[model samples]
Target chain A: MQILDRFRDPETGRALLARVSALAEQAQEKLGRRVVFMEVCGTHTVAISKAGLRSLLDGKLELRSGPGCPVCVTDYGDIDAMVAFGRLPGVTVGTFGDMVRVPGSQTSLEQEKARGADIRVFYSPADAVKWAEANPDREMVFLGVGFETTAPAIALSVAQARALGLKNYSVFLANKVVPPALHALLVDPELRLDGFILPGHVSAIIGRRAYDFIAEEYGLPSVISGFETLDILDALYNLLRQVLAGEARVENGYTRVVKEAGNLRAQALLDQFFEITDVSWRGFGVIPGSGLQWKPEYRDFDARVRFAPEVAEPRIPKGCRCGDLLKGKLTPRECKLFATACTPTHPVGPCMVSTEGACAAFYQYERRSS
Target chain B: MPTGNKSEDVILLAHGDGGRLTHELVTGLFLRHFENRLLRELTDAAAFPVGEGRMAVTTDSFVIDPPFFPGGDIGKLAVCGTVNDLAVSGAEPRYLTVAFLIEEGFPLADLDRVVASMAQACQEAGVQVVAGDTKVVGRGHLDKIFINTTGVGLIRPDVDLGYHRLAPGDLILVNGNMGDHGMAVLAAREGFGFADQVVSDCVALHRITGRLLDELGRGVRLMRDLTRGGLATSAKEIAVSAGMDIWLSESEIPIGLAVQGAAEMLGVDPLYLANEGKFLAVVAPTEVEKALTLLRADELGREARIIGEVKAGGGNVFLKTALGGTKYLDLLAGAPLPRIC
Candidate 1:
């Protein structure tokens, strides 16, 4: 109660808002145009919507949601492959709840589950290990998904399964790293981003040094931010301050949780179990070194190696501008299929299904007056 | 021979065969707990006295997983659910008819405990169990136990509470903390060990509603029990039904500490979680203070507060967050599941 109450203090929150507004106005005047900043984490996107931070800013600055939601960015072909593995005999699919609703090339895990495929939602990767241990006769296939903050947990689960000699447990690794994806976005000539509000959780694991390239190469001011209202506002203020001062550098706004070097043990675990690979994304397509693949030593724990599921090439949903949305080229309302054809109940794209996806945030929090 | 031991205490198909076993269960277990004149007649149907005013009838089926929880069980939930339904409809619930579908091999002691809890809940609501029936299925055919209750109540002509009666500027009040029942059930099911156990807030709300009706007649415009879809869904339904909009303050909505913590850990929003004992009441702005005072004086309404107000608009529901931003509070799409991040 103390922590949540302090962060949610109305007076202090209002004061921060005023300060952020003043800074944003100064930056806009200095730049002679609207300054755009992107928060590159799905959790930050949800927090922003839940706290109504976007409306509070009200065009003083533009906040674009990037490819932070792992579920939203997972390739349809990979989802199809996982669903196929789940449907195989003697296999139990354990996944995060967000992935169950994401559509594959053929069907979603939820639809497959309704048809009697054994699919279970696990909160953590450790839960999947425990489940595999409990049911020794059946094979457990965990859909390991997320950014660096979650990659180590999956890596640890893999290590744990190997230590226990769990031959029947395997993971379909779709783990993504944030820095490479940010690099992919920065290189796009169409996207002219002024600054970035970095993901706190990922930064906590990979550290502020991971984002040094964005500042050194692209001269973009990047501030690592927490998910709370004040944390986000303070980070926005920092970004504005950097832009107004004509300075582009990495700043740690969430110093309480994130450090410069991050958790070394977690980075070590990631290095031990996974290697960089070219993985497909839902909207952004294939990006080199953006995904994590299981190391050869842990091949027995890789579902792709064990099942070798045959899936067709992924196809984007027609009229869905998720790719454009992820690149900050379009808002949710600008998309043609936003409210009419694509909704949370019947999501046509991964972005609409995931809670942190920009489309879902906009649909759930915005879209009232429209 | 009835043995007072645990070996032969489990239920069997013979208990539903209408033989001596069935009679023993009725007379020895149910009748003993629900001893009233109408049920004492032992007839196929119950005959009760009726009043002249129009009557309200409602029925609900309870198939809650894990029949027993910390604060209450499926039996108590069944009674309170029907009683609250009738209470919000501006009716005095009088008689209830309960039916049970029990699984074979279930412990008879557990059945007895559930029946006793149901009787106790009926007493608290000032209602009587006039009639009942039971059936037993083979093992694996059904969960441990399921309960269905049909309630009959009389509605006064002078009292009219409907969505049509709602108007703009009416203040919305909720009678206690939200999401306690839901979080408690989730924690108990998953065996999430917390220092402080979260118990379900399952209690009857008829007494508080009765007080509000008696004190401020016609001031209460609409009332609804926050159950499966929770307060957000209820508010959305009311808004659509009344052709108006409802605006709520996130800070004003009361959520218990344990509930909030559990919700956050599960990546679920408290607004969509279920509550058995809570209800949302819409009152005229003039009687907002009086309604709040009356609600606060009662044990069940101590945490009650005005969460929002109704406005003439696009028939939507919105929440003004603590950070001075507004967002739509949409109806729940499906079950609230735990997130990965």
Candidate 2:
């Protein structure tokens, strides 16, 4: 509570915002164009919208939401595979609640659940293990879908299941890495980004070292910032200062939580159980070494290997501009299906369904302004 | 499936057959608790006199997953839900008809306890249970017990309350803390085993509303019970209905410590959680102070605060964060799911 209260101090927050505004003005004047910073984490997207940060900045600074939401970025084929696993006989599909409504090519897990498929939402991966233990007769397959912040926990669950010698527990890994996706964005010719406000939570796990490539290779400023209002302002100030000074480096604005080297044990666990593979992103397409898969030794606990369900070809919804939104190519208001055909209740794309998705954040918070 | 004393024992299929066992169970359990002249006659229906005024009638069924919870049970929720619905409509709830759907093999002692709770709730609200019915279902067909209550209240012709009466610059006030009932119910169902058990804030709000109507009259523009969709949904409904904007201060909204902690752990926003006992009252700006004073004076309204204000132009609800930023408090999309990120 003390830490949380400190970040919310009004006097400090105003001071930080004033400094951010000043830097934004300087950066824009020096460059003779708007300074655009892309926040690659979904949590940051929600926080920026929730805090109304966009409205506070004085037109000099433009923030774009990247593919931060794991559920939103998951390929349609992966979702189809998950739904098929949920429908398997004596199989209980465990998933984080964000994945329930994400539309697959044919159907979603929520629809399958309503049709008598045994699908349960668990708060943590360990909960799925406990559920598997309790119902020994049924197979429990947890849909592990997240970034570095959540991947370690899922890896730990697999290790725990192995330690407990639980035969019925498995994981359908759609886990993604953040740094590689950032690299993909940097190489993309369409996006004209000046700097990056890195995801705080994912940085806490992967550390600042993982983001050095953004500064070293691309010569783009990057700042790992927290989700608090003042933290974001401070991060924006740092990014602008770097852009104005012609410096390209990764700076840590959320040092209180994120360490330089990150959580070593979590990384080790991830390395021990899983190997990097080429995973298809919803908007960005296939990125090599961006997805996590079970190692050969741990393949027994992989749902894809154990169940071997027939996965269909991935398909995006017609007229959905989610791919453009994810790459910072378009805003939610620019998309035709933003509020009309796609909504939170009846989402046409994964972006509208996930809370952290750019479309969802825009629809929920920025629609009126747009 | 009978247990304990034969005269007062477990519910069986015979109770629904309308035979000697049914009569005994009804007389022994319900009649004893809800003793009134109309119910004593035991007719097919109880006839009640209506005064010379407009009447408000509401019916609600309670089927909480866990029939019993920390602060209150299904019986208390059923009675309070109907009574609050009528109270918000500016009516004095007077009569209620109670019905029970009991699963076979349920303990008679539990049934008696539920009936006793209902009788006490009705007494507190100054309403009488004039008619009642009971039916028993087989195990696995239904949960332990379900209660349905129909409330009738008399409304004065001059009294009117709804979104039509609302205007720009009106104030939105909620009684006490939000999300306590929803968080409490979740805690009870999941058995999160927090250091301090979260008790549901499931109580009747008629006393507070009744007093407000008496003092403020037409100054109270709109009143709604924040039941199914907490404050966010209720605020959105008012905003959409009146075609205006509602700006709530995130810092001003009162949330209990336990509820906040539990909500944080569950990855759910407290604004979307359900509340049984809380209600949002939109009042004229001039009467805001007086309404707050009146609400604060009541036992149930101790922590009441003015959460937001209604404005013209935009048809959306926004929350001003504690950090001097604004966020939209949109209508909840689906079940409040725990976040994976």
Model 1 segments beyond 4 Å from truth?
A: B1-9, B13-21
Displacement of residue B228 (Cα, Å) in model 1 is 1.5
lDDT, candidate 2, A150-176, per-residue tens: 888898898899999999999999999
TM-score of 2: 0.94
lDDT of 2 by residue, B109-167 (tens): 88888989998998998899999889999876888898899999998776789888989
How many backbone clashes does every candidate have? 0, 0
- Our model 1 lands, by Cα RMSD against the true structure, at 2.6
What does the lDDT read for residue A221 in candidate 1?
97
Give TM per candidate: 0.96, 0.94
**TM-score, candidate number 1:** 0.96
